[model samples]
Target: MCLLAFQLQKHPKYKLIMMANRDEAYNRPTTPADFWSDYPDILAGRDLEQMGTWLGINKQGKIAALTNHRDFSLPETGGQSRGHIVSSYLQSNETPEDFLEQLHNSKNEYSGFNVLVGSSEELYYYSNIEQKTEHLKNGTHGLSNAFMNTPWPKTEAVKKLLCDYAESTNEIDVDVLFNMMQRAERFPSEQLPDTGVGGELESMLSSIFIASKEYGTRCTTVLLVDSEDQVYFEERTFKNGVFATAQKFSFTIENPTA
Candidate 1:
């Protein structure tokens, strides 16, 4: 997940509301969300090349999502795929804090990443670069290539939109939320972050939706789990910046958070 805005335990009817866009290389092999035959409880899109996932929820009500830290100066290879962090956490018996502690101890084995995990009662945030696990507060929060809610222009803009959505009504409108992810505006050069990538490249990635010939926003996802434990997950995939298809799944969660 490249850009996301989520609210945990902030609404009266819904316990978790998350909308994220997964930006990946067009050449990377990927499959839409599903319940793995080997792990029926796990529901998420798969990174076929690496056998991992960017975001998912299980029958146990565990939820997780991952984003890569922006630092082009650092090499992007020779490390484990960060997507595994989400899948492993969702499948494990460990609590969110316990799993993050294990990850913190062996973080160097993976590349730079930001992971969000836990249950409806609480959500945890951890980034290898930040090297600290934080319990996310009960409010709408934004995430991108940097740390959680670091106030990137796009992050701030989308976060505010999410916060307003949560505050405006009890039922979420998936169309409106998904439309917010299609923004392609470039941040003013002065507002852009210098993450060692070239200025031109930075400009292209500055928007909420990233579009390029080689790499772009491959999928846009919206997930909502209500107080009744009903889950709604939808993923709209794209091919080289063009619309492809959407995968929709719904189920009742029975997994225990404790």
Candidate 2:
């Protein structure tokens, strides 16, 4: 996931509400969100190149999402595919704390990346850039290519939008969340962060919904886990920056707990 905003245990009717967009090259082959035949319980869009996923969830209510950290100055170090980290966490029997501990030891094996792993009731956030895991508090949070909640223009904007929507609404609306993630307006050039990528590229990526020729948002996913443990997951795939298809799934998590 390239950009995401989520509220954890904050809303009245929902346990967790999240909206995310996955950005990638136009030619990268990908499969829309679905239950993998190999990993029956896992549901997520697959990056065909590496057979890994940026975000995913399982029947046991395990949730995981990842974003790569942008740094051009770093030397070329071929590391493990970061997407596998999400898939690995979802498939693991270990708790978030334990899994993160193990990941910290092998952090250098992967390129810089940020990840959120756990269930709706309790979640943990970690970034290889920081090398620490945070027991996410019950509140709104946002993350993007940088670190978690770094207040990059788009991150703060999306975070506030979620906070307002959750405060005004009593029930979760998948469509509303999707619309929020669809904003493509670019922030002013002066407001864009200099992540080592040149000015032109940085300006293009300033938008919450990136739309460029060769690379842009491939899909948008909105996931809601209500207090009753009902999971609503919807993904809209795009073709050349245009909506192509959408897939929706609903399930009641088995034995949901903190």
Please list the Cα RMSD from the true structure of every candidate, rounded to 1 decimal place.
Answer: 1.4, 1.0
| Tens digits of lDDT, candidate 1, 1-78 | 799999888898889889999999999999988899889999999999989999998988899999999987777533
**Worst 10-residue lDDT window, candidate 2:** 70-79
| 240 Cα displacement, candidate 1 (Å) | 1.3
Candidate with maximal lDDT: 2
lDDT, candidate 1, equals 0.90
- Please identify model 1 stretches exceeding 4 Å from their true place: 73-78
Off by over 4 Å in 2: none
Clashing pairs in 2: none
Clashes of 1: 2
Can you give the TM-score per candidate against the true fold?
0.96, 0.98
How many collisions per candidate? 2, 0
lDDT per residue as tens, model 2, 129-179: 888999988899999999889989999999999999999989777888888
List of clashing residue pairs for candidate 1:
59-255, 60-255
Candidate number achieving the greatest TM-score relative to the actual structure: 2
